[model samples]
Target chain A: MNAKLLEIEGLSAGYGAVPVLRGIALHVAAGEIVTLVGSNGAGKTTLLRAISRTLASRGRIRFDGRDLGALSPEAVFALGLVQVPEGRQLFARMSVEENLQMGAYLRRDAAGIARSFERVYRLFPVLFERRRQKAGSLSGGEQQMCAMGRALMAAPRLLVVDEMSLGLAPVVVDQLLGVLAEIRGEGVTILLVEQDVFAAFSVADRGYVLETGRIVREGKVSELAADPEVRRAYLGVAEAG
Target chain B: MLFAQILVNGVLLGGLYGLMALGMALVWGVLNIVNLAHGALIMLGGYAVYFLFTGAGIDPFAALPMAMTGMFCFGYLLQRLLLNLIVRSALLNTLLISFGLDVVLTYVAQWAFTADFRAINPSYAGANITLAGITVPLARLAAFAVALLLAGLLWLLLNRTRLGRAIRATAQNLVAARLYGVEPRQLYAVTFGIGAALAGAAGGLYGVVAQITPYVGTSLTAKSFVIAIIGGLDNPLSVVLGGLVIGIAESAASLYLGPTYADVISFGLLVLILVARPARSLRMA
Candidate 1:
């Protein structure tokens, strides 16, 4: 059986005419965790958005052996390729439970949804504890967890996370990374975008370094960490790790 | 005892008023468009029901479903063809277009129905019940009951059903709502149609209780806006309670502060609510 889960070739996209992601090419096998590390405005979020069909792009995006670029965001989600967009855009006025219920927005099987809620609760006990609270009332860390939990409610085969570590303390980031690692163990393909080089490398099996909307280097995390130039450019260190 | 009667009267009338705001709330909450034409749509519903009952000899109560169905179709087409064209445009532009639609609709209504008052006077319109020294107009009571019933139905649609959930999701985030396999055009059309239908039903009830004329559109639209804001945008029934609040306030105003200030009070409340909670409404907008 074919194992390639997602393949992007010559993907070019941007807001109107100002192109951001230029001729980007990448692939992810089933159940592999890949991280894209880039500085601000490097088009990492745009790439994820393009895959989710939230942005207009000219490229071939094949997800789980099907063209994804043609599909709308909802259609893409139906295919089990969901994106947890940046900024944790939870419906603030909605109760935490209502917000979570939205995660199963496209689903019909109530029984399975009930079971998924149980799983989500098990994953993040804080969300379960404050199920009735307003989502906006939750702190930033909790909101991020809620965002992840909401995305998981879709039963995604591939999860695209944008800046999960942003505006989070080290301890909170560590906790989130741990949960992500656990999610990875469940054989879910992950495309992680982050500015935190350390966290991205720590959890990702392989890493793609993006500089100003272009891929500069792609390799195994260990191998990339050992390269002097990659270390200097991406990690802000000249010495080999 | 007189005060008690006044309060009961206010509560009953408030139920229908809440119903009026319910549609506006639903459309505004989910569609993210403060439908300036909402009251006009309600007025149209009233006229539709009025003509159906008076011309066709259909029982006024029975004619409701037919009127609702007609309004729903009209609203659906309006949204799908006209409103959808500028839905993606600037908010100010959408508001102006809806306002224009309101003007056209008001003028057309005046031409068809003529410049006169209309009330859907079923035989049962005058029947009343006395409970604990308070006289309850049977029509008003029935209208209030139906109003609550409709609100209950809406609550069920939005919470218990998948389609309802998608509607809600769409309201919160249009993209996310679409991600749930909902067609934006179809979904939006359906939502607006439902809103119109609710307005039609409310207008039918309201016509029996109060005077409705071509000019009624401006005030009813303002009242709906006031109730919707007072009720907040999250739940449908809270808006009914909001209506009740306004209803009681108006009742008290009529008895004590005089009737002319009723509109003033609600509009004042609207201004206060909008100004005080600009942050709250800002996020949703």
Candidate 2:
């Protein structure tokens, strides 16, 4: 088996006084698509934030054999872990092209960035058409595409996407999932946090069921889909067995 | 013809005023730092140019870049080492700290440069040209041109460059910026440095036109605040236009009312605008 690209153990995190994540542990192997699914306010976003080092947390996060302790968010990003945060937080006033360029802010190689720009434009052709338009003007689906494109511009090893389907139409969600698979085929690891259990299970190889900040179940997506508790509580589907 | 000349004078002075507010606007827009000490930084820039001219015989125009570079370094270090520490604190706290910084910087300038007024008087300082029956001071015209050039350069930097994109991105969303591998601390310092550099340039030109004393920062700071609000935070050109509006207002006020009412009119307009359309400036502070 390939080595674990990201390993989190005994992680705990929270906003100032409101503890959100407690004793959580998870891992994703190289080139794997891992999904973390839970209801709203279940600490899914907080876990990703902790892994990205954007929030203060107590944990041992070993990424690519390096300890991610005491690293700033930028340092964590330099290690090739990037997050497409919730709300498609594109610089609203900036043009789509400029927003994509911002994704490569730390990079100095001109040719490499140009290639990334081409790749992103090809992946989302609408973005190419609206390259000069302000990002805020883009539709919800377009903004989502721009956000994903922006994340790709960073050439991330692990793309952490939070709330992939939030505020997106079903068709757009399916389109994004297809793109995620294509991205995974390019050898980038994906750690996705979603409230849409069924949607996440469709693309994810492995899954974790988080309940109020704690991982209650961890298994292959097939097994998770079969789990009666998960089906009843999250999938809202009746059990066959 | 008299009105046209007054308009030109007001516009020229307004150019310098716009340059003064540019830094404040950038810092406020990007780093969310309302640098109360901005005026003091301008004073320091004036002193820097004054010394370079008096002691080293460098031309005042040539000394402008030197002052900008010096102030940039000073502002950069001040942000990296000091301001960043309290940046995550409450807005009121940041405001208080900046005010404290203003006090300290003002006192230091007073100690080093003395309380006497100084001006940058080159050999051609009194040179003038008459264009279409309007008398224009050569230095003021040059300063006005420089202000426009600087504002244009700033617009290009923000729109056409990667670093500028990073700075703007950082301003819009810190978390998103980090994902792009931007270290906020360094970026914040750079933004503040650029703001200070603009202030320095403004001060350098200001010394050519007006008297420079250690105490000039307070009123200048107030003027900058008004201009920044009038201009809005995003566009550099708008900020310059905002400065022009104030310049014309001041020129007209001083001419029609009295010299003493120049400030009163400016402040009064600010209050009127804010009270009338609170939506404009409310988002900023």
Candidate 3:
């Protein structure tokens, strides 16, 4: 197995006095595609926020073996733990090219940035076609693609994508899943959080089931897919006779 | 002939007015802070230029960059140490804090500068150029040209540079900006510093064209608000256009009615614009 890239232990986070995530422990190994599958309001977003340091949390979050508790969100990003947030928060007024430029904001290497632009254009030709168009004017699927392309421009060692399949059609989700596989093949570890368990499981190597602020189950994707409880709760399969 | 001269005077003054609003519009756009202390920053800029001219033997126009640099540092510290604390608070809270800052700055200026009315009067202060039966004050023309140049520079900064892209991104989505490794606090300080520098430049020009006292900030701040509203907060050049609208209106009002009607005309225009398109004004704000 590859070395662990991100490890979280006993992580608890919440808004104000209300707890959203409690004692959530998960780890993603380098070059692995891991999925955190949960229904809406199961604290999936809260967990992602905790890892990104956008939400205040208490526990040990070690990314690439460095403690993340004391670091700011930008500092976490500098360490190559980038997050493509929920809702595909593109700079709506900016052009597609400018949005991608923002993704490479921290980098000073002009040649590397040029290469990233080429790679993003290769991955999503639609983005290239609409490079000068305003980001807000893009279709929903295209916006999601732009968001992913923007994150990829960062050249992140580990990407944390939140709710990639939300509001997307089946075909679009399939295409995005194919890209996720391609990204993993390039050795960038992915922690994909999704409510669409089937779509997530198709791309992920390992899976974790979260319910009401706690990790209920975790294992290889095949094991979780075959489990009766996961099937019943998430996959919408009725109990076997 | 009188009409043409008044129009020329109005247009010249309008450019400076637009420069005055540029900083406020920028700060409002990015930080979402109305910055009641903005005019005081302008006042401080006037004083800096005044002292540099009188004490250090620097020309008023030449002292502009020096004043702008000083104001930039002042604004950077103001945002980094004080304003950043209350930045995440409610809009009303920011308004109140900035209002308090304005009062403090005004009082401090009154104490230090002795409430004396001072104007930057170089040897060419009264020089004028006549064209097509219209006489234009050389200083005012120079001030207007500088205003347009600065606005163009600001436009280039926002649209052409990497730092500009980061700022625009941060203004649109703070969370996304953080994801791309932008430290909002540092960016905020830089933006505020730029705003202050612009205000300083405007202030120095104002001292040359008009008068400067500790009490000048209030009316200047009010004028800036009107221009910023009319211009929209998105573009620097647009703010200058907004200033021109006010300048022409005021000059015409003073010519047709009386000098006292200038403020009345500007504020009245603001009210009419706000009432006519409440939705647009609300969105801009």
Candidate 4:
């Protein structure tokens, strides 16, 4: 197994007096795609928020051997753990190209940013074509592509994407999943939170089942897929094949 | 011809009014701070230019940038040390705190400068130009030009520059801004500083055309808020246009409905606009 790139131990986080994630422990190995799957309000988004430090959390989160507790959100992102937040929060009024530039905000390397722009444009040809159009005007699938492309411009070593499939057509979701595979092929690690358990498990190397803010089960994708209880409860498959 | 002359005057004055509201709108749009003390900052800027002209013998126009720089530093510290502490508090808290700052600054100005109305009387103050029988005062024309120039510069900054992009991004979503390596605390201070600098420029121009006192800020602040809301925070140029609307409205009111009714017209328009576009105006605020 590759060395752990992100390690969270006994992570607990909540919003203003109510605990959302309780004693959650998770890890992502370098150069691997991991999926965190759960139902609605299962603390999936909350966990990601904790990792990104967007919300206050209590626990030890060590990323690339640095104590995350001591770092601000910007510092944490500077370390290359970038998140594509839920709902594809692109700067709506900004053009697609401008949105991508925003992802490269901290980078002073003009050449490198230009290169990333090429890479992103090549990956999402539609975005390149509509580069000058406002992000809000784009179709849902295009917005998701822009969102992922924006995250890529950050040059993330470990990319955390929440609900890449949300509000997207199944075909679009599949296409994005394919892109995710390609992104992983480029040696960038992925931590995906998806409501579509089947789709998530199909693409991920390993999976963690979150139930009510705690990890109920976690194992290699094959192991979790074959687990009868997981199938019955989560996959909606009454009986294992 | 008289109506046309009044219209031209209003247009020129509107340009300055737009400049005044630009800073308020930028800060309000980005920081979500009402900045009730904005007019006070403008008053200080007027005094800065007045003193530079009287004591240091500097040209009022040249002193504009100097006052802006000083006000920028002052705003930076004010936001970083004071407002940043309570930025995450309730909206009413921010409004109350800013109002308190306005009172403190106004009293301080009164004590130091005394309750005196001073105008910046440069050699060009009385100069005027007549084109097609519509007379234009050179000072007000210069003020109008400066206002448009500043607005143009602001538009360029927000749309063309990297720092401007970060500021706009921060305005939209702080979390996303951080992902782009923007530190919210520092960025907020920088934003407020820019806003204050713009206000300082407006003050310098305001002093050139009108009289300034410690109490002038209260009304200017109210006028700025009205312009900001009517203009919409989406674009800087639109805010200036909003100012023009008010300027013309005031000029027409004073000319036709008596000078005493100008204030009533501006405030009345403000209330009517707010009452009419309840949702759109409320959202901007």
Candidate 5:
């Protein structure tokens, strides 16, 4: 098995005094696509925020064997743990190219940035086409692509994507899934937080079922898909009556 | 011919007015800090330039960079140490804090430099150039030229540089900025520093064109607020255009209704704009 890239232990986080995530322990191995599937309001975003250090949390989040507890969000990003946040928070007024440029903001490596730009363009040709257009002007799917493309521009080791399929057409979601596979093939481990369980299982090698901030199930995607409880709750397969 | 001359004067003065608003607009847009202390920073810049010219024997124009540098450091430390602590607080809190800062700065200036009006009188202070039928004071023209030049430079800094990209990104989405490895506190400090430097430049030029007193800050701050509202906060050139609008309006008011009505006209225009375009002004804010 690959070594763990991101390991969390007994993590608790929330907004103000309201606790959202409680004692959640999970890990993602290097170069693996791990999906955390949960319904709406299941604290998926909260967990992601905790990892990004945007939300205050009490827990140990170790990335690549280093403790993330003391580090700032930017420091976490500098360590190659980048997040494509929920709701596609693109700099609305900036052009697509400028948004991409912001992704590589910390890198002083001009040649590498140029290469990343090429790679992002190659991955999302539509983004290259609309490079000069404002990010706010893009379609919902395009915005998601731009967000992902922006994260990819950072050359992240572990890309934590929150709801890639949100507000996207099924065809676009499928296309994004294919791209996620391609990204994983490029040796970038992924932690995909998704509301669409089936779509996530399609791309993810491993799956964790989180409900109300706790991980209730974890197994191979195939195993989880075949599980009777998961089928009943998530896949909407009615029991034989 | 008289009207044309008045228009020329207004245009010349408008450039400086726009320069004064540039810093306020920038800090407002980026840090979401209305920066009531902005005028005080400008006032301090005027004093710095005044002392540099008088005490160090440097030309007032030559002293601009030094004043700007000093103000930049002051702004950097101000934002880094003090403003950062309460940046995420309520807007009213920030407003009160900044207003208090403005008062403190004004009192300090009064204590240190006295309330006496001091104007920078270089050898060419009275020099004027007649173009066709209009007379343009050399110092005002130089101030106008410098203002436009600085605005252009600010535009370049924001559009052409990597640091500029980070700043714009932070202004749009702080989370996205942090996710892309931007330390927002540092970025905020730098942005505030740049804003302060612009104010410093404008202050120095204002001293060249007009009198400087400790009490000059309040009206200048009000004027800057009005201009920033008229000009959308995002674009540098637009802010200057806003300044021009105010400058022309004030000059025309003084011409037709006598000099004392200048403030009345400018504030009246502000009221009209706010009443007419409430949505745009709110969005700009």
Candidate 6:
């Protein structure tokens, strides 16, 4: 209903020579939290990589009305788009505070950086407490929080998060999902690739079910949640459509 | 007493050597370029200051910044026009391209400078100050101090400044770097230029205490690699300590064995250290 913030038409992509995503189409509305739900090897991560231009892709991806096919990964990032990649790829050698500072690398306004630093610290107070310690030393849950915080430091208009709940305890996942909801509330759009079905579906407004690089199901959260086939195959529920 | 004197001398020399490696380390750490030609740039810096002092009648120390500025431009253009092409391609490509540049520069230096071993002989060159029976040559001490000062400045830049933070981010991931809204290509060139400027400063100081020739690059490069690796590309302080280790090792070898054996000793240590900590050394680097 909102003007489309991102639109993909017949987008095809792959790593190396093998094609993973075959002419997939998807969309995300402005200021909306869209969850791309899929199982392992379902091209969820690959699609994000394609959107971020980290992997080579074909077809048209228009983000905020700009052609994304021609942009380099760095160029895509410069357009206020940031991704919290799989496995929380924080710079392990850097301190927690330094890692967050790195996210603001493209920014020049010192006052804004200081403000964002405080905001991230407020979101994850544990990070503020351990800001001086090396990022590698943090617990897994903390690292995920830090990864999201690092992405936030970039002041992204659209945050593409891949597997934020992966390897995280349920409690930690709930906390991160809650914070993400708050970040989205503050006008940061999110494209979440979630493996945890319940956690993702609970917060998402729109949902797309990716199966082997194609969108097999697309609808409002309530529609997809009640779709018997989606529940049976993806949601692990004993229901038939 | 003799061992103490040797150790002190080694540390002084090591400080300068560490300074020499600092540029290579920075470039390698941030830019991810091995920059086999780094020592050649250092040699050029020495020659620049040498010519400025002799031809233009400028004081060598005062002309140090001038030489560094020139070298920075040279490095910036080199990266923009040449190194940038293959920087995103592969490690082997960068290594090969930089080595080619090194050879080209070395040959050009030989043709232009005529293989002369030039040293900057300022009025304070021979002066020495002694404290508690330890004599420190004025030129060497001044060079050592300059080296430490530069290292401190580099540390502050990486840890305290915004440009330094961006450079570190580029070092980690270019995608993340771009998201922060910085142009990576220009950032890379700037980072390379800074590395070259550091090398130029080291070279100017180096000419004060040592001899320079077109051939000086090879040894300095080997030494720089050793220090950069042993220091582990993460911290500037590690590089200084790395330089100190090599300096002490070289001095001990020269004093205990023959002077020629010092090369063997340092290289031997370099090989042993690299071989021993293979994974840990590279991961941080």
Best by DockQ: 5
In model 6, the runs with Cα more than 4 Å from the true position are A9-25, A53-79, B88-91, B275-279
Error in Å for residue A1 of model 4: 7.5
Clashes per candidate, residues 3 or more apart or on different chains: 1, 0, 0, 0, 0, 1
lDDT of each: 0.84, 0.90, 0.92, 0.91, 0.92, 0.87
Docking class of 6: medium
Off by over 4 Å in 5: A10-19, A55-60
- lDDT tens digits by residue: candidate 1, A28-122: 88888899998898889888878888788997999988998677777788899977778887867566777778888777798989987998898
TM-score of each: 0.92, 0.94, 0.95, 0.94, 0.96, 0.92
In model 6, what lDDT does residue B53 have? Answer: 84
Instruction: Tell me the interface RMSD of model 4, in angstroms.
Output: 1.2
lDDT string, candidate 6, A152-175, tens digits = 998888899999999989998989
Better of 3 and 5 by TM-score: 5
What DockQ does candidate 4 have relative to the true complex? 0.72
What tens-digit string does per-residue lDDT give for candidate 5 at A150-175? Answer: 99999899999999999999999999
Model 4 ranges with Cα > 4 A deviation: A9-25, A54-60, A65-69
| Candidate 5 residue-wise lDDT, B137-206, digit = tens | 9999999999999999999999899999888888889878877888889989999999999999999999
Error of 6 at B279 (Å): 4.2
Candidate 6 per-residue lDDT, tens place, B105-183, comes to 9999999999988999888889999888888898888888888988999999988988887777778766555655657
Question: What stretches of model 2 exceed 4 Å from their correct place?
Answer: A1-3, A9-25, A55-60, A70-72, A239-241
Clashing pairs in model 6, backbone N/Cα/C closer than 3 A: A106-B180
Question: How would you encode candidate 2's per-residue C-alpha lDDT over B34-66 as one tens digit per residue?
Answer: 878889888888889999999999998999999
The weakest ten consecutive residues by lDDT in model 6 chain B span B173-182
Q: Give residue A73's lDDT in candidate 6 (0 to 100).
A: 77
Candidate 3, superposed: residue stretches over 4 Å from native: A15-19, A55-59, A239-241
- Candidate 3 structure quality by residue, lDDT tens digits, B1-285: 988888898999999999999999999989999989889989999999999999999999999999999999999999999999887568999899999999999999999998999999999999998898799999999999999999999999999999888888888888788778888899999999999999999999999999999989888999999999998888898899999999999999998999999999999999999999877665642
> DockQ, in order, for the candidates?
0.45, 0.75, 0.84, 0.72, 0.87, 0.54
